[model samples]
Target: MPCAMAIWRVYLLPLLLLVLLRAFTSLPTQAAARGGADPSSGTDDGKHGSFSRNLLQDKPEITEEMTRGYMSNSELEIAVQDFGRRCANVSRVYSIGKSVNGSPLWVVEISDKPGKREAEPAFKFIGNVHGDEPVGREVLMQLAYWLCDNYLKDPLATLIVENTHLHILPTMNPDGFALRRRGNANNIDLNRDFPDQFFPINDDINYRQPETRAIMSWIKQEHFTASAALHGGALVANYPWDGSRDKRKQYYGCPDDKAFRYMASVYSQSHYNMSLSKEFRGGITNGALWYPIYGGMQDWNYIHGGCFELTLEISDVKWPKASELLVIWKQNKMSMLNLVASLVKTGVHGRIFAADTGRPIPGSLMVKGIDSKISASRTFGDYHRILAPGESYEVVASMEGFTPKRTRIMLERESMNLDFILDPDGAAGQTKRLPRDDCGCSCDDDGKPFLIREAYLWLYLLVVFFLLVLYLLFRRRISSRLARNPPKRPVAV
Candidate 1:
């Protein structure tokens, strides 16, 4: 019985170990199989798979006939093309990206040097964030046309065209507009699709909507100084912080609260009747004070892109009659122009240079009281820092391995032009590089890379484990052979 037990330990034990190893190796495969088993499962795969399934199952199809008078998706595309051709000198139209339903997100860039880069600030106006709020899309198109016609004709228009790059995305949610819904075709709200400060819900880039991703990518590429998204359902201009730390319905302000309030007032006060709103004071409201929401694009722009963005609720009633569209455009036209003009009209505009080399260096600009900073452009070393005017601010310009320069300025109603020539620090010899965004490299998405690294690690472990098992098996077999046939006892000398 003892001999039989030893035999089992040698041969059977090895076989048992092999079975355990195989089971261990198959775990990933089993998990993958289970994941693939239910193709229609409501599991979010970070891309469009899960949402696409949900769209097909739950949402109702909207036909072109249902949306009359308004431009169809194809018509909107045609209008963009026509504008590009008609306003060839002042405007250059381009597509930022495509939506989930494969519609191109078109942008009409209005500038004297339309497609060229300059030391000037850039401002973007995104319309139709929610599909059902189609007023913005229409109003934006009118704004584009007005700019095209009035450029070199209208002083304010020429000012914006010559001094700043104005990018207008007419319909961010074409898929949602086609469906006539608040959310996109996948039933996801684009406003709530951005990365939230208080929550990690939208942190995964893979799970983001194509429209939201497009906006994020565009912001990185353009380096906008300030921006606004046209929405409906209210009449006041909204600014960050869109959410609160405690998740309560209260007035939670961002670091640049004063500046944001000024920006919001620019839009609201410019509007024909926005200032007369009894619901919101001064025709402007803090976003969180009204109602807190997470993953809003307005707050994300301020935090991540270094752009002062306002959520402008243009119309009190969303989806108003088609005829009212023209009236709405007329009402909001000055607000749009003044907002774009604000980048040039009221802000601290400057370029940063290396004192030793006399060459432009991408640096950062900050105000004394403001907690946030804006980066200078790599090509021109130009930075546009928007602040509430008529105040004294100690402006600081900083760069890696350079002695930061500081200046005290009493910024007035007119925009202030200030330049900084940073000297190389004697203590720090070599110049340290700035972050990708600061260095002018486009860091589009924020998705983490741990999954890929983990996958490689598991593969490495599997290869090592298999080799270890093979080595043990070979050793066991050699030991058994040596035990069965021992050499002639070394032929005793």
Candidate 2:
């Protein structure tokens, strides 16, 4: 009996060792499957390290008449051509240049009124500046398809295409995209390659790549009103000019600083779940250079071209899976439409004052003509509002001391300028009010004030609560596991 028990123990010990070995060996594969780190590469164990694998293995094939989340260089080319063919009335494809590897750099222009392209202000969207950050390319491609397909059905889409010229270069670095490398075929970072008239290029970074030169030339010729370059690895919309550092060599603010703030705020409000007015409190950091980067696309666009350019880092993960593309598309599509549509027409500026006291009244003013919307201006004297063109509309100004002023105006033309002065009795009196309809006339759809969307606010709160609950559950599980398997003690000192 003793001999048989010994034999059983010996066999069981080897079986247990074999099972442990298999489990240890499978850890890397399991991690990769969960979108985690690659054990083979001794790098940081996170989304960044395994981004390429996720991109390559998970993306689906592109198809015509249907939107796809993932695509390769050749697949994307075919998809773009198909989109052009399907939406021949509203879209056109143009070749900007060729990559170093002889791949064509394609731009898909989407506009409802194709013949009226030259007359309108163009807004360019480029993606995949870093080869590994492919989410932008997918998102832009999806947007192009959406804009072209839904032109007649969707009011916002129709409005944008009818008013503005949207130029989308889905892949800026085809060679790098093909190779899945951060740098182009020539091993140059395209974002840093723009011509710096003041700061000359040096060996620390190479800024004279062919792709960058082509982009600069295009910008000079196109005179785009606003542009956005999309990237990944960080989830924030960064704006220019990004080359400045403060007295401590810490990343600081850009020049033309106010414009940067305005544009960044616009982007955050339109897309991310954060306040546009504040910086870095929620959502993502804005304006301030929290990271050190030089010769980026946004800085070049703002400084040289005098255009409002933004760099939208779409996801915290380096290369998000094809499945995650749709979520990103939903978040960015409206913002993209808003940015382009806002540029088609300009804003109207005016001042409000008390008719009785002849003093400026500061308060909230609502402009409802082309579009029913409200805008607030510095109440002390001047107020500026932006609205679209149509015909009959009303402008109402309200304050505590002054009676709410309401006036009717007709904007038959494309742009109109008008002014107003409010009487104590909420009537338009005989005072030469500044033109309220000045500047270019365009509709302002800033959406319901943050308070009115109570349902959305509650939904957001619920999501936060759920996430907190999940975190606590995960923390407890980890704690219990640690307690059950405490670390083994070392030998006596």
Candidate 3:
């Protein structure tokens, strides 16, 4: 009986414990893969994620066709291609990746020189994150078409087309749209699918949906000064930190809280009625303050891509009548244009170069008080920093091997272009090494390796436990042998 019990304790106990641990950890993974929370309960948008989708969904099926008069996936592609052909000199169409359902994630680069690199800031707009909230997709297409039609004719459009590279991804979740659900074909919410600053959910890149991965890859390749994602269900501009550290719902702001607030307010104040919202008090709420959601895209963009992103809930209704999309586009047009134009119209735009060789140096821009830093372009050493129109800011440009340069610029309502030629930190020609973003510890993704190290501690603990089990098993066998034979009393020595 003791032998049976020992065998069970030595082998079955560890196996059982292992099984329990795996089951414990897999709960959130399973939940996330299945769309994290129930969309029917309005958990996707919380107070601001979705609008009265329940009431909309309650309508008769006969009205479905009328409500969905928005462009089909194929129709949108045709529109994109037609615009590309018509505006070939100013625009180009390209695909970032494919959806789980094999629909292309198309992007329209609207610029004077669409595919070329210039000393200009890049801005991206991602729409149709949720399949049910199709307002963003239609509005984005309208935005693209409007830009294509008005470029060289409209001053604002001409400024954007000539000075900045605007990348418009009309629909990010075609699979979700095709399925008419909040999540993708895998039923995963793409917005809640990023690696969270608080929770380590979706840390592994593989588990991220194809659409999510495509956006991640795109941002990594492009240095966007700022960007915004379009959403429906609520009329507000949402900024991060999306999740609080204590997992509580409250106003949790990141390092550049004021800048984010300003960015969000830019959208809300520019909108037709967003700034008049009674609930959000300016139609802009800190994401976590609205409701804590882990693994959101806005926070990830700010943290990893070094881009300022606003999650704009542009409509109070998730799926309004197709006729309302033009109104929606009109409402958001100025906000969108002004937001992108702010990159080139205001703030400080500059290039950093080596003082000795007169060569461009890929440096980073940082305001003395602001905690965040923006890396300069590798090709042109160009950097664009967006600040409120009227302010006196002491901006600093830094490179790894160079002595950082500081310039006090009193930026008025117009843009300031300040170039820096940094001297070597020590010797005239020698350089000091600085950290790279691709290092195992990247500042792009929150400079903390604390989470990964904490996760590794579990493997270390498991290894220690396995060693303890082996040691105990050996002792138990020795004890049983000694009990059985008494060890011959050491031959009476």
Candidate 4:
């Protein structure tokens, strides 16, 4: 009996260990074979094609059966135009540009004063970056409709419409959506089409895809305070420095890292199940920390457009059933609203104007210690500087001709209004008045011009005296010069 027991322990345990190892190793192959999501994937450029990790495993490949009830491109266009007509008072529909297949990239600008530049922060939502990810496009359309239907009736909706210019691009890549693929008509990933900070893939202007060009142009035309591009196949809010400097997959954070983390948290904490995610802690991640991808839209918006942007992976499934879209919207509703409201509810918003002229000046805004700078709009001089609350900051506003003003504020939980009326650096110096109103709310009143008048009087007198002295000197010098060297007489007529 003792001999039999020893033999059983050795043989059975060894067999079991071998079988377990084989089963664990076969999991990926089994997943691939079942047409289920496998982490293995390749890029449109055909690089990194099979290095998908467990975290990146997607839903089974999208099929026609899955997209049966989804809106077609023609139907989407009609819907957008219809939305414009129904909500014309708070919305305007316009085309940013066309897709590769010449499908108009329709944008719904929602604001109390649509198509006008007011002293307000602008936010944009771009959906359908990937052709296969139809969830974002549908959900974004739902967002627009909700805002239209709830405006004035809902407090949050009313706040957004009256105080913010919200731009909704329901689909950025219609050709990709129609094809039901991961890329555009030319098969280029629109997300990777932007010029990367570390790579030269899209440096040449002419070489960019039409969809990428349109977005680049649109950002240039509008001074968006913040923007987000919606995506799926994951559920997390991603923030910038999408790639590391060394081209390694590591946590590469941008200058506004803290502020971005706060913004991302605002979305995750507001969501129903996002904060409960077991994969990503707190449902937020730095772009490079997740997986280093260059030429991404989020990083470009932050770096070039002065727009603080987030890449939102709002769904775990890339192509969810059409019926599931409404539920998805309901889950992400508060997140979307809170994110837009952050522009007005948590930021330092104000206009920069010339004190003497009272005209809006296109100025750049910078926090005292932070390296990054956001610019005010050229039309309205309005700038929105979103920051984490409960901290003191020295907000600096500067224009080329105006004296840069720096004022410190103890920002509480709510947003603070800090309008800066900068005097011309030249004017302040010429007047020599009281260190140029370098402190709090001094420009609120031009009530007393007496000091300016006194300074001007002295300046005028000094200029006149100098000019009279110069004239006498010139007379004396001319008389002496004529004695030394006679002036040439008119010789030829």
- TM per candidate comes to 0.76, 0.55, 0.75, 0.76
lDDT-best of 1 and 2: 1
Q: Which ranges of candidate 4 are over 4 A from the true structure?
A: 1-60, 427-493
Better of 2 and 4 by TM-score: 4
Worst 10 contiguous positions by lDDT, candidate 4: 40-49
Give the Cα error of residue 257 in candidate 2, in Å: 2.5
Q: How well is each residue in 65-114 modelled by candidate 3, as lDDT tens digits?
A: 75468888999899889989988989899999999999999999999998
Q: How many angstroms is residue 50 displaced in model 2 relative to the true structure, after the best TM-score fit?
A: 26
**TM-score quality measure for candidate 3:** 0.75
Could you give candidate 4's per-residue lDDT for residues 1-493 as a string of tens digits? 4654565478745655665554453333322232332121111221211222244445366678898989999999999999999999999999999988899999999999999878889999999998888888888999999999999899999999999999999899899888888779998788877766565533467777899899988988888889999999889999987877687788888878889999999999999899888988999998888887767888778877888999999998888888898899999999999999989899788988888778777678999877788877766677899998888999999865468899999988899988999988874332222222212111325644434444445556556655765686588678778999998899896
Model 3 / residue 182 / CA error / Å: 0.2
- Which portions of model 2 show Cα errors greater than 4 Å? 1-69, 115-118, 202-207, 245-255, 272-279, 282-288, 345-493
Clash list (residue pairs), candidate 3: 45-49, 50-233, 51-233
- Against the reference, the lDDT scores of all candidates come to 0.80, 0.60, 0.78, 0.80
Please give the lDDT score at residue 387 for candidate 2: 38
